[model samples]
Target: MRTLTGVDSACSVLAGGCDSPVRSGDSIGVPMFVQTRAEGAYAFDESGKRFVDYVMAYGPLLFGHTHPALVRGLDAVAADGLVWGSTHRHEVRLAERIRSHLPSMERIRFTTTGSEAVMSAVRSARAFTGRDLVLKFAGNYHGHFDVALLDAGASARTDGGSGSGIPESVKRDVAVARYNDLDSVDALLRGREARLAAILVEPVCGNMGWVAPVPGFLEGLRERCDHVGAVLVFDEVITWLRLGLHGAQGRIGVMPDLTTLGKVMGGGFPIAAFGGRAAIMAQLAPDGGVFTGGTHAGNPFCVAMAHRVLDVLEAHPEYYAQMEALARRLADGLRAILRKRGLPYAVVQDASVVDFKFRSGPPNRNYDDACNADRTAYAAYYNAMLERGILLPPSVNEVMFLSTAHTTEDVDETLTAAEASLEL
Candidate 1:
């Protein structure tokens, strides 16, 4: 019998040779390397080639692959059980930890994924306000759910319609606004024929690269939501712990009516949460008209992992500082390299998250501006870096992450790779 190669086996079992289409390597025009193991800041492919990982499992492995503390915590918890399918102590404790940092989460409910959390949050907002319309910013992804899948308009003036299978009716109920633009949000809210239920945003845009909110942008959203009685939902799934210990809301000092959290909270496991004012959250069923539940929601194992992640973060405030320092070093080095070569590029960063855009200036404060970046240039850079044993997100629109497990040495090595890769 012949043994199957990694790509061959993956192609046979998984569509596109990867669970997620982004990992397919089609964007880079190269065959994807199948990773067999990952530890600390590096991952080893099937061929035993080591690559420094900057994706960090798309933002969940905050402590990096198979962190010792996380492994020990999971091992201890696994000895106890997997799932009891009932209320557990860990769930309650985890909720308390999250609420301590995000006071806006007066009440909380866990879900199996960030998508579910966002879906439930929208439902609760609609139920609580008895309003049908929800305004979501363009390029600020909430999940693959239909309501959140509506595409942006050809121009900012018109409301975006649904993508493929989503009904036109669903598109009518959802409005698209430009990120970091107060006027765009105000226009939609003011023109509303009926009351708007919620305005969901990514506090700090991550879906369309690592763009941040302009000054007074979030504050303006808060004011608009208050005036129109619309729920302001911050989708902090990617920015939760990546921005800071307390999340983007805490870092920016702008609070929202409801918040959705995931990614870092699970510490490489599957867990997410949605919560807000007790009155608003009370709308979720078992107690209210809005309904949401999952069998694995808040299962002990995921909850235990989440609890351990929070504990580790709380114990080590310096972890944030260290990672931030490393990120700054990397961004600075890359900027220096680009400047020396007289290349037109923009490096946007916030704390441990950074992204590169091939443009002469900073990205304009909207998705349209981000779209103008040179993808061809990025593809060339990505392939070059990958060949040099450095792994970056396959797409230019995605942000690269830094972890506590990364060292100054790792940052230096990445810079060296970037200097060579950018020559493309």
Candidate 2:
């Protein structure tokens, strides 16, 4: 019999046994468990261990694993074929549905991934403004693309250099500012406003563990961008449908000139989009000069799943509230457990996401504060939870997600496991 030893050896055919760094276990202090199958709010590992899943496919499974509607919609759409490499009605309908909720998106463009959407948005902004410099907040991950990778989140290292092979010229065009702080943004723009093309932000700072913008912070970015003639781009990749139908911009009443959305929009498939004012989006190729195209940009299967997810959410907006309530319950339970155990920690809840930090003090307000999380303690706690059959976000900085499929009983069971885990 072949002894595989661990996940690393099992995934020998793949680089580092994972495509994404966070999926690996080198930093988490345990071998990454192999999940063989998943259902609504639960996943079973290769060993047949049942675990309550809070990872939720890293924030895309809003309706939970393998939703019946998604499965049915995709099944029906698959009969017509997956990709046509041409325009389709499903794409048009999805775009119209998204525009109905986000009026700021006067025109929209679909892409295969959030990174492509962001890259296109930046290209459009630069083309429209005839400027080069783009401002991004520290720890707000846009994607693995070169310009957006600097000062990215979800990395094991904190030197702010996400990965190698990025050119120095690309780094020069990008400037990093501290999240939730308008002063840092002002300082970066004071001497370079004329050359600034866009100010990209994750309105809710999901990458930094649900650190939302301080009051007037997003508004400040809007005003400054207007004053400087620079486009304001909100990277709502994680907060898109998860925050609300209108996204963070509509929920907070601070609209951006451009917005990028993904995750829940695909309903577990891979699809993302970016759109804004008509004049700006018109700069894309065939219409203007900036070029971006993918064979599977608006895949039929993905569009069908997105439409199904959106239809359910639009008809029953209360589902958002219910998910938030469950997340709040989980957060409250964590707080109670930590307090009773005299563990100094913070559990931050925003909508359907809950972020717990193994550190003493108030909730994290920015990337710097989020960095203070005790990874050692979190690793131990993560192992304990895993032992008890609860799968959380493997990374310390990642947020735990709640789905509509997660029931009250699941929350109670999680708390029970959490209590015992804390004692471990």
Candidate 3:
């Protein structure tokens, strides 16, 4: 009924999406469909095709688009002042709110992107511990920092693996450990436990498409980190506010020494933060020595946006419950379709983050389970859904997100689309 010509053009412009050089980090994806634009739950491309959004800014648009609550918060803050080179009310308030969510945090610092927040956290760990090695999981993406560009150890590299040209020095300082496999991490630490500055993780792997920490895996890491005196950092940039007001830390109950936050914290705006024990955090800036500063680190627009976004999450903790119920409905509905078609499919998710593993059998428990899924089937399903008016994240490596804006009716319509697209 509608078309995605605009999505193509925009991606062309965004990717080359236009005429400019596509920078490595900033280019837009060739949308599965595009045209008019979007409001809440749905977007219309130039061709007027209506598609339900399954990619809510990669888990940031929790309350959906142009939310009145966010708008009001932004408007009120914006009217007061744009940016203060000095302290401001909203900044202190936001910090208090963030600390309240994760009582473990004694100090907090804001940045402009998830990458920056994570980078700062890692740097702080190195400073506080005086150790150089930073450990990260395969398939868990922390940011574009030279050290974090690693691929998961088991998954195929062709599907967005580690990049090249990084200094051997940088790569040497970083180590890649297997996801959900405690033995693998145990082995890495056996010989040189004291050298590790920090063990950075996603807690739930979204970059490799919705994998979660194995039971006892997190607590074990906590024990290991404490034994060796390394900081355990959770890169909750995507999972932070989406999982709960306190984010993955609150939901999973495995606290990290430091937490990096983004996505939902910004409410579709550019903002990120890292916080942890006060003494360790004091190692940053005028309080200590980390040598980092950003002119636009915490601009007014971002503060306004984040404060509004977070406040709403704080007010309606019930939203997370609603999102979880909706996610279960979608996951179960798709499983029924796979069963009906006699096709192999696995669904994975925690809270609002969900995905279909186009594999040969049952749902996977870790990255390996996800890698075993059927890529061809997923691509075909993706094309069919595009044709039908539902928008999903393009790459299998990314997890699908749900927002407060989607309704049961929308969920059912999506299920119908999946059934038809499955090819009986």
Q: Give the CA lDDT, 0 to 100, for residue 311 in model 2.
A: 84
lDDT winner: 2
Question: Whole-model lDDT, candidate 1?
Answer: 0.83
Summarize candidate 3's per-residue lDDT along 373-395 as a digit string, tens digits.
55666677777887888887666
lDDT of 1 by residue, 241-314 (tens): 88777899998999998999999999999999999999999898888989899998999999988888888988
lDDT of each: 0.83, 0.87, 0.77
Error of 3 at 105 (Å): 1.4
Order of candidates by TM-score, top first? 2, 1, 3
Error of 3 at 407 (Å): 0.9
Give all candidate RMSDs, comma-separated. Answer: 3.3, 1.9, 3.5
Candidate 1 — worst ten consecutive residues by lDDT sum?
152-161
Query: Model 2 over residues 198-274: C-alpha lDDT tens digits?
Result: 99999998787778888999999999999989999999999999999989998899999999999999989899999
